[model samples]
Target: MLTWAGLLTVLAVLTGCTGSTPLFGDNRSPGDAIRIFPEDGAENVGADSRIEVTVPDGRLERVKVTRMEDAEHGQVPGRIAEDGRSWAPDKGARRLGLAGKYSVEVVAVDGGGRRSARNTSFTTLVPADRFIGYFKPENRSTVGTGMIVSFDFNRPVRNRAAVEKAIRITTDPAVEVAGHWFGDERLDFRPARYWEPGTEVTVDVGLRDVEGAPGVYGSQRKKFTFRVGRSQTSLVDARAHTMQVRRDGELVSTVPITAGAAKTTTYNGKMVVSELHEVTRMDGRTVGFGGEYDIKDVPHAVRLTKSGTFLHGNYWESPDTFGSDNTSHGCIGLRDVKGGSSDTPAGWFFERTLVGDVVEVVNSADKTVAPDNGLGGWNLGWSRWKAGSALR
Candidate 1:
């Protein structure tokens, strides 16, 4: 298991490798004797492409492939056939990357051991299409174990299978990950249980030129990665008016808190923190409560849901209000000073919290939060989660 710190190592090591002049052979060599699938100087090749090298007469001694990706050149590992007349990439790595530039270098030999080399390069097709998915947690970021890889597509995906198949996600130590589509435009992926602390996840968005809709095609080619940090989950007991914080499955601390008022009960279920703010405005009207309240600057606010549910610091209430009362408009409140201070409970918790950390509310009068609400998919049973997968 690799911790959040592991993210920096991957970023530094895999950062792009620059391009250079052709190697292993002369670019001016007469490639007439060698045959390449993407022909020499070919252009506009599709994603479902074949790359091979063969010699009509002599045996192919060696074949090398270099793909220009993210301004980096990665060698394609392959094996020459037993006959030594043809060569292709390794089984799983055969799928050529979309919108990439590939260069193939080959060497052929006869019984005498004399070598003749040929070099060829081609460019893959760049999509003139418009369907793209905007994903979260950012490339190379380190998030908490509760983080779920989510996507919000720019348009409705009619060919869900085609679009989903193009995107591949893998995790270190090899845990099974499954995708669950919320609707035609939103998709999310996660393991059956919360990710173990210190796991590295990689995503290859090979959607470029893939038809996602009737006529619209995918228009992005990208590879990104993120790491899982330490595990932290807070259990908010609405009835008891306290929150129990745990780290690595061990109880750490318990703090007094206040949940929603009787008229507007807070939602119950697992909700992941998606954003943090030192201070933010909270207006009832914005969240569909017709102007009941509007605070200009709520300090130490942690956003929990898209529908304006927050776990924020409340300075207006009396200190005794927490731990003994439920008096908010569907938000959870922690005690803090006016502007907010590190010494206050709310500020202290906010400083230590990560974006993907979980905050589960129990014993609340309101119904469970919907699975589509702020990474609430954790509330869904494993069987139900897989049922939402477009792949199914």
Candidate 2:
């Protein structure tokens, strides 16, 4: 048994050995000792700005950055410095959105095994003008082999290289594809050759807040897919007065046809079938030949160009003219009944045709179609087509 003085002495020695004075308030929890770049509540940060954090006496365990408006969050991938003192977001994650607020959170652990967290927010600079690119063919659409992925921009892209890099094309059974800029307003993508039949194609345009020029920014983030259908191409020989149709490279039919007359000859080159109709109106004035003819309900019309051009039934003309003569204002005319009978040449052709079918005009007196006239990129040589690339 120990006396009261001895027991008090033992208790004092034990307390002195085990006790620790609290350095952070009364709880002894480690203080948040993180140093963040672009400091807290920063404004007008650059779109390409990066986030970095340093812990003098600790190591980072996790970091996250999120867009405030969309709540889109991404984990910041980083590795501790060899000395284990500093951390930074990956190089690829430096592309922040323009005119947007972002929230950053970091959690770290100290040498004592106590966890600490710090959060910061920032806003990116906003530009004066924003541009967007509208794309086609539409999502989930099944089109023929001649279909080209096209993009039309609302504003001109001066920095063509930057814009082109932002656009991406992918195929399931991968094929090499390239993009060509047609002026500053249009961009088109296609393989060196036509897409293989039944190929699945996907387009991703990640231009959101991309700086296209000094004051012009891009504002589009889009994804769309299309599938290629069976192959079909038609050859229209104006001099021979015939149209030869082929399916999967096999000659299927040869029908007599009348191309445009001498004064208004049809454009000669490759064109894609963009639209088809069983019956539609054809007004000469619409194609710049004022009041020469206005036939309502023309049968089995198929549109070939953005400008008024079509392969259509001509019931007003005598049937004999189709096989032997070329007499019309810039259109290919086939013999057919007024109401589009299935047995007629025009009806038969329309029924078998799908949007994106290729039509090439040969031996015509007219000059070759302008590359931008229709889907006429095929008219350009491979070298010339590649020369139009911004990346080239």
Candidate 3:
């Protein structure tokens, strides 16, 4: 019914409104290719390490890591990173063989929702049978001044020379650094004295399946950098019943602390703070020597050992009993409220103790704290402890 002139006008109007048609079609992009970082060949990884994957021109939706010869391979445990592409292994991932190859697979999607995948095998530098330690107060940084670099091995190391060689330490101005073996599985690296404040430190661990003991091996290679913080080491001798807090070996403050009683003697040795809790429960039955009538709740317990020793607040004890008498079964009790909410002496001291601060106990009739208990590395004699190593 429309004339040619009218049809031409309508067509021209539509064409101008729509503009030119696209020759390349919709604005869709291609799928991305998943890739693994650290490549196909990587070495010197820590035993407790994670895997990383990457994707280009896309984002990874999922990832899988599997050890060869084992069917218990794993997919991504947590949320994948944005950009359609990266994956990290679980925090507690464990592999079978140390030197064997591991297969990793990654799946990704592009901006256009196109799917892509990648698979590759990588040989981890760290082996199974090995234990490696990464210590705190890293090399070359300001620390708590009382902090120390401590390592915990899973197995006892017998190869002292090899194990010691695997670890390297250096400090500013070249201070004398030594690796003191405190027990079969613990090694405390320190200078002759506390680290100098405002100084830098470096530690290198070059152990990968290096034999340490009969069946123990090491699987870590690391270089840590940290700085020195303030200097504070408080010495508490039970004989003096006085705590001398020192900075750079000079006396700062001396506070009086009541230790263990004669019958229930406190441990005689150097102990480090393993943990701190504002208020924790103390079970008498768990430590072996309690009937139904015994007190089950020793509140405000700040545990110092796995064997049930603590520096806790005791509300049952009199307020004036702290500095005068040692009445606890084996622990050092400080006066506090019944519910562990009190800010008494025990609460204050326990709150101030860091996880690594050294608390020396002497003159106790009880045996010294074992080096293997908690982080009590200071219990062992340096030379004697070193002799226990197989590498020696």
Candidate 4:
């Protein structure tokens, strides 16, 4: 009952224009040839979500998955399957980064020589629990030759191997660096011997979404670099009350000092200066000695041990007390003024020291400092140090 004009209008609306896309846009018979996982506009995707791009009957030309807002760790690495139709991520990148946004761009060529491209985005779910690592030597810092890379985690790690593997260390003018685990919470890395002067070290941490324990995920993904400055170490003779400073194997200064009294002897062994303070409070009560002494202002304090040992300035003692006799409570003291001065022995040494500089104590009654106390890994032999690695 319809006329030719009316019929033509209905046919045009139904099939669209000749050889052109339909009204709803590219409504091809097979739709788009390219297929992307974690489809566009997805939110709260699981960390273990499958991520890939595929074409039903085509060869993938390009596939790039990038993490949003992290330029340092920009892309998620993957490879096209042998069949040339699919792509998958590497084993290390299987798990998506928790609380991270990702963008996927893909390109493929179909059997008919037609090309297709797609761009999609997704956001991963926030974790219920996350573990982070606190690392040492600081980024882009210049430390002494004895500097060691250390990490202290807030929570205990049950999967030590996985966590260790996540940390990648590389050096310029490369040397062999090994990692050692101190129980479950601390990890340290060092070369066989002290690092050569001017050596550049880079640490790449890719622990994001790694399961450190049951249901506990790691959340740090970053890179850090540091350079080794000149080598400076000091030797403290507790029995003789003298400290010898050395730089690059050259004897620089030999200054008078006072070691721990006989009853409270200083620890003997290699120690690293982990902290430096111009002035700090030293209370005997804090270190298990009650009513002995509490100094409100101890100057030029260089921390040597976790058990309250320091090589600091001493103004309260008699001027002659330094070279005469050892009289202190488990500390090495150098004669100094009430307020620290640059001309003083303690001040001169502090100025030349770096955080990673070594301070070794000899001829003391106390046993060698434990390898775990401060950065005392130098106390361990090369073989023993390597054996402590989880990888070993």
Pairs in steric clash, model 1: 2-198, 17-72
Clashing residue pairs, candidate 2?
none
What are the TM-scores, per candidate, against the unseen true structure?
0.67, 0.66, 0.55, 0.68
State how far residue 53 of model 4 sits from its true place (Å).
55
Model 3 over residues 53-124: C-alpha lDDT tens digits?
765565776566655312222333544665545667556554434543455655566666744444445554
lDDT for model 4 comes to 0.74
Candidate 3 regions with alpha-carbon error over 4 angstroms: 1-130, 134-148, 156-158, 182-184, 209-217, 225-228, 237-256, 291-308, 338-343, 367-392
**Which TM-score value belongs to model 4?**
0.68
Q: Which runs in model 2 stand beyond 4 Å of their true positions? A: 1-128
Which segments of candidate 4 are over 4 A away from where they belong?
1-128
Give the Å shift of residue 147 in candidate 1: 0.6
Q: Write the per-residue lDDT of candidate 1 for residues 25-81, one digit (tens) a residue.
A: 222233335677877767778877777787767688668787742323478888998
lDDT of 4 by residue, 1-392 (tens): 11111111100000000000111111121355667778776767998889878887969877889775232335888999988899989878757776666877676767876555555567777546987676776777788888878887767999999999999999987999988899999999999998999999999998889999999999888988889999998999988788888889988778888887877778899998876767654545445554466553566778776556788877777666666678877788876665576677777777888888899999989889888777889999889999989888
Model 1, 264: alpha-carbon shift in Å? 0.6
Q: Candidate 2's error at 5, in angstroms?
A: 99
